[model samples]
Target chain A: MLKGHQTWVFASKPVIRSASAIGGPFEAKGPIAEDFDTLHSDLMIGQDSWEKAERTLLEEACDKAIEKAGLTKETINFFLSGDLMNQIVSSSFGARTLTIPFLGLFGACSTSMEGLALAALMVDSQSAEYVLAATCSHNASAEKQYRYPTEYGSQKPPTAQWTATASGAAVVSANGEGLRVTSATIGRVVDMGLKDPFNMGGAMAPAALNTIEAHFRDRQLPYDYYDLVVTGDLGRVGHSILSELLPKHQIEIPLDRYQDCGIILYGDNPDVWSGASGCGCSAAVTYGHLLRKMKEGTWKKILVVATGALLSPLSYQQGESIPCIAHAVSIETE
Target chain B: MLKGHQTWVFASKPVIRSASAIGGPFEAKGPIAEDFDTLHSDLMIGQDSWEKAERTLLEEACDKAIEKAGLTKETINFFLSGDLMNQIVSSSFGARTLTIPFLGLFGACSTSMEGLALAALMVDSQSAEYVLAATCSHNASAEKQYRYPTEYGSQKPPTAQWTATASGAAVVSANGEGLRVTSATIGRVVDMGLKDPFNMGGAMAPAALNTIEAHFRDRQLPYDYYDLVVTGDLGRVGHSILSELLPKHQIEIPLDRYQDCGIILYGDNPDVWSGASGCGCSAAVTYGHLLRKMKEGTWKKILVVATGALLSPLSYQQGESIPCIAHAVSIETE
Candidate 1:
């Protein structure tokens, strides 16, 4: 049902039957490495190119997710997946192997929850018995498309956050025993005249705050409704901005419970600059670290707000402000 | 109810309340010029950059859609949109102006029906009172990202198609006075080792056939069920391939009623090469021309299958095969 303004309250909540995460060497050495199912020692992962490596990572994640759910690819009625790559080839190539009816999404970094929301909706509406939601990002692949290639070794700005070379997948279904998606808040694009693509956190912060505000207002829920409120990849900069802006908006949540996947992934590593950010940042963190905490009963309910900076190299070079959006989905273990 | 293996039977039968189409000068002279709501005299639309021109096109289409429906932006619950642009910045930036909750999608040329299917599903599920589906493409923007800058004027193969400088949008509601979406068939990614990005139609033809076959098989319907069966932008090459392959797979439909938007948008112009191809190609054709025909009773029921070539400049440079998918939606007059 439609909630207050922008939220959809899932009447028949969809459950996550199983989920799996995969990461490359850089992410493998990060703080949350133990949470992922598999971590490769190298970026290439035996693949010739970074793009192929990304596809291979996605394939393995999907396969592992299905296996963990005690099912096969045939059981999945549809697969909703996306990535940061141009035209989203990694997810599409991965879909070729899975052979499931596919729907490709592009919300930039917000694709993880975007896919999850759609998959949950399908299961909740009985349109699909089982749906797979997945997303991936490769640092090398992203660098080549968005900026100079890694081989070019251009000087990097400290404001630039590292794109995680990882992938995560989840099997969403009805009557499954795991965390259930109770509600979803789709976001409106918000541009704040921030033109710097290197500082994506600055570009995406307002969008994150906007969605979080809408979620709370539309649901008419106080801050205590969840144990945590985690943002996708706002990194340190955007996290601080959100923290400052929330109270200004008269919305208050415990400071300690407010975490960001970008900040958590690298565990305060200076090499990550502003911190980790990408489609895989939230995906690997949510499906891996968050799920682990939920299974351990450390958290019963939480809100995941995934932010996306919607810009291209052309758009940025053409002097366009970065438009951003953030989708929020509430997950509860019951 | 769940119909077959991959089809979703929309029980609520969402209706298309209103739609709008915008075309640049090139498309304004096309075969279906009369169908579009607005036709600009220039590709730039008086904007400084082609990217901004693309964004302006989307905004106008969306605004016209809502206005034609006798509603405002606030009445729309969600907006699902995409384009050929990398990261879909046009749709995203357009969303900022519309201020509607948005979900960005990517299926290349297949985006129109993919968006329609998602919008219909949302309305049918009662998740939203109204949803808007839209897509756009500019030849200049596409060329700059996919191949060469338009100013470069690189030589192209005859098999290549022209990207339309156009945008199309439709408003979907639970109850409205228009054609209703009865069912949708999501497609599978089918890669046939075709590495040529220039020949997208050839790369996409098999994927289109695969979905059309599944749609027919899943619905247990024959050729006579739909008065017209159209594939998105398979162009001339893909159209011929599909026509030949259908009979081999024991599928037979009237060739006259079977058409491709790629062929229909332009009046067989030699400069268009194979035909018109873009996210806008199928969208403007289906939402504008075909819908007008439906209203005029030229055709009562139809199946629109939108095909997408999922590839990237990086993918092609790295020597990866083109992966493609097609999504089909059935519209009917009751």
Candidate 2:
């Protein structure tokens, strides 16, 4: 079913049967560390390169997701996934090993929820019996590709956020006794002419606001409808910006209930500059912490707005401004 | 809508109301030049950078698609697009300008039919009344990112194919009188342990064979069920490989009716090495040339299997074997 505009109301309300989150040493030290299913002591994970290590993380998370659901890889109809890798090699290489029908996506950091939203749509529409949605990000791999390698020890700006080394996977099915996806609002690219690459929170905040605003308006609901409204990997800066922008848009939800995955993941770690930011930041938090809270009867309904900064290294070098987007998914206890 | 193991049997059978193809200088001199809606005389397309030129091509093709359908851009519910660039900036930047709900995809060269297949599914399921499917590739931009800049004038290998400078867009609608999309088979990654990046045709042929075989098996269709079974951007070598591999799989079809977008695009141009190969290669040829032939009653009931070699420059440098996939969509006139 279509909402007013920009949103899809999943009539069947697909259920998330099982999920898994794998975190590295850094993520394991974060605030919601206990929520993660597994934590690695090292980033390499016995792989030759950081890229292969990232692939290993995705593979393990996916394997765990199916096993937790009491299912095998053959039972999953499709693997809808993406990553921050240049051509999304981690997910693609993982798919090669998983041997499932694959749809490779790239939404930068927002890819986790983006994959989940699309997987839910596929399952709800009866296009598949079970679909796997997953995403991963490695701090070292991302730094090497998008910025200077960590080995350089380069001076960074205060606005720079730490990338989490983590992977998250979820299994969406038509019939299940678990968290249900009710609606989704797909986002549009919102470019505010902000060119600084380090200030990704500033670049992404506007997109988050745009999609969040659209979701509320199209659903004919107040800002307080969701028990929690969370933004993906938008650190303290972006979170503060959103607090200011929402009131201006006539949305007046309590700031206490409006949290950001980026800020909440580490819980005021001084080393994490702004906050934890990556595809894995939201993925690990949502599939781990939020779902655990919902299962514990701590929250009834929640909305996740996964935001992405859509800019390439070449685009930035060519003086092109960043294009940002945010996709919102609503989940609730069934 | 789930037909068998992997295929989606669209109940409503969404129609392709209108499509537009824009070709660059190299494509302007190719075999299907006259079939394109617009052709630029220069590779740059009057833009300062090749990336922007590619984005402009996509924008033009999308605008032409909606306009030719006698509809405004606002009526198109979503835009599904992707390209060969890192982070898929061309498509994302294009989406920023297009201002439609965007679902950015990345399937390397197979993005054309992949976009078309997803758009058709959305429309068939009534998720949207109209959706835009498009992909583009700029030769210079691709060469700069994947290999060397064009100005280097480096010696080439006979196995290396030229990337097409072109863009193609199609408007898929729920209620329309046009070519209808019947079924789609989402592909699984198939790796043959071949590592050469120059020979993408060889790398992707096995995946193409995989999906094509699955489509036939799942749909319970015979080998000659369609007038044509065209593989996307396989050039000559992969085309011959498929010819051999299909019979080995015990699926025998008349070889005369078989075609490849890469081999057919340039029509025996020696400068193109084996043949044209890019995201634009299949897109430009299919939406412009083949659809025109279908409208002219040249043939009916065709299966388009778009293939992609999902290897990045980083992955190639990492010494990983190429991973490949091919998505097949059935189109026919009613």
TM-score of each: 0.98, 0.99
CA shift of B216, model 1, Å:
1.1
For all candidates in order, the CA lDDT equals 0.90, 0.90
- The local lDDT score (0 to 100) that residue B254 gets in candidate 1 is 81
lDDT per residue as tens, model 1, B15-110: 999999999999988889999999999889989888889889999999999999998898899999999888888888889899999999999999
Please give, for residues B70-153, the per-residue lDDT of candidate 2 as tens digits. 988877788899999999999999999988888888899888988988888787767788899999998998999999877889
Score residue B276 of candidate 2 by CA lDDT.
88
Residue A316, candidate 1: alpha-carbon lDDT: 85
Write down the RMSD of all candidates, one decimal each: 1.5, 1.2
True contacts kept of 2: 0.67
Model 2: chain B TM-score relative to the native chain B: 0.98
Please provide, for model 1 over A1-334, each residue's C-alpha lDDT reduced to its tens digit, 9 standing for 90 to 100: 4523778888888899999999999988888899999999988989998889889999999999999999888888999999988888888889999999999999999999999999989888888999999999999888888999677778778889999998999999897689999998999999999998889998898999899989998999988788999999999988998899888988888878899999999988999899999899999999999999999999999999999999888778877789999999999987
